[model samples]
Structures are given as structure tokens and as C-alpha cells.
Target: MTTEVIKKPPTWFWVVSVIALLWNLMGVGSYLMDAYVSIEQLEAMSQEMRELYEGRPAWVTACFAVAVFGGTLASIALLLRKKWARPVFIISLIAAIAQFTHWLFMTNSVEVYGTGVYIMPILVIAFGVYLVLFAKKGIANGWLK
Candidate 1:
């Protein structure tokens, strides 16, 4: 009988996986806050902020949900050493790009929120891409089965 050897992941693998989980959890928290903001909370915002929040399209919200939730699941899969993490991370990355595309191009978010608004979306997309590449590398290195 032929035997198969399982490769052990490096320390960095665990570190990255944990970071991914925490990042995605924060995304999920952001999504929840946005999705469930109360009327009082909305009224407390400045006119521009209120308009931006109330005027967001439903599809953009859907994309946000998919991106954050998918990333969270992919993070869990990575921690579990599952090969499925790669594809899920790819999906999350695509959704994050879509969500950010709307924020960057289809809306006046940058103008309303000032240049500072760009930072989070840019970081989100960058991290999404990084996680996808990391998962692929993990699979290739036999760190993820």
C-alpha cells in the first residue's frame, strides 16, 4: 500500500489565518451595524452622511454581505486546513471588488466623506486579494488539504 504524507504548515500560516479571521469578523461587524442602524442613529448623522447612508443601493449592500460573510467562512476554512478556502477567498475578493467599485465609481462617497473614505475600501480590497493569494499558496504548499 502506498502511504501519503501530510505536510505541516509553518508558523506564519497560523498567524495569517488568525489575522484573516479577525479582519473578516470586523467586516461582519461593520455589515451588521450598517444593516441594522436605527432611525435615531440615522437621524443623528449630518445631512451628507445621512444621504450617503440612505441612498446606498441594495445590490451594493448585497455585495457587502457576500464579501464579508464569504471572507469569514474562508477564514474558518483556512484555519481548518481545507482546500476549499481558496475558491471561497476568490469569491470574497470578487464581491469586495464589486462593493468597492460602487463606492469608488458609482457614488460620491469620496467627495462626501472626504479622501479618508478611500482608505478603508482600498485596505479591504488589498486584504481580500492577499487572502486569496495566501490561500492558494497554502493549498499548493500542502498546508491546506
Candidate 2:
């Protein structure tokens, strides 16, 4: 009888996986807070931030939900060695791009928050793109089933 021994990912894979999970969890927390904060809490923000938050359209909020939720689920799928991670990560990247587009072009966020606000969005988009490619590579290399 032949026993097939499955291959395990390298050390960096586990490290990256855990870090990705933690990172996406933070995004989920931010999304939850943004979506469900109390009226009083929302009122406590600086006028610029409050205005920005209040001005967000339903579609923008929905994009935010998709970005965070998709990223979070993709992380889980990656850890579980599921092939579905690729598509989920791609979804996350697209949602993230949409969110960033809204913030960068559709809103006054940059004018209100100064150029520093752009940095995070850029980072998020870059990370989103990286994760999509990462998941694709994982699948192609047999790190993900």
C-alpha cells in the first residue's frame, strides 16, 4: 500500500498567514465600528471626520463591508488550504479599489484630512493587490488546495 504524504507550507507561509489574519481582523473591527458606532460616538468626531462619515453613500458603505469581509474570509480560506481563497482575495482587491476610488476622487476626504489620509488608502490598495497575487501563487504552487 502506498501512503501519500502531503506537503506542508514553508515557515514563512504560516507566518504570513497569521499576520494576514490579524491584519484582516483589524479591518473587520474598523468596519464594524464605522457601521455601528453610537450616535453620540459619531458626534464626537472632529467636524471634518463627522462630515466625511455622514457624507458616505450607501454604496460606499457597502463597498467597505465587502472589502473587509472579503479580506477576512479570504484569510480564513487561505489558512484552511481552500482554493476559494483566490477568488475571495480578488473580490477583496476589487472592493478595496472601489473604496479607495470613492475616497480619493468622489469625496473631500483628502482636502479635509490632508495628504496623510492618502497614505493609508494607498497602503490598503497595495496590500489588497499583494494578497490577491499571494493567494494565486499559493494555489499555483500547491500551497493552497
TM-scores for all predictions: 0.95, 0.91
lDDT of 1 at 117: 84
lDDT of 1 by residue, 1-145 (tens): 9755558999999999999999999999999999999999998999988988889889999999999999999999999999999999999889989988988898888888889988998899889889989998987888888
TM-score of 1: 0.95
* Candidate 2 Cα outliers beyond 4 Å, as residue runs: 1-6
Per lDDT, the best of the predicted structures is: 1
lDDT of 1: 0.91
Window of ten residues with lowest summed lDDT in model 1:
2-11
Model 2 over residues 1-145: C-alpha lDDT tens digits? 9754336778887787778888899999999988998989988899988989888888888889998999999999988977798899888888888888999998888888889988888888888888888888787777886
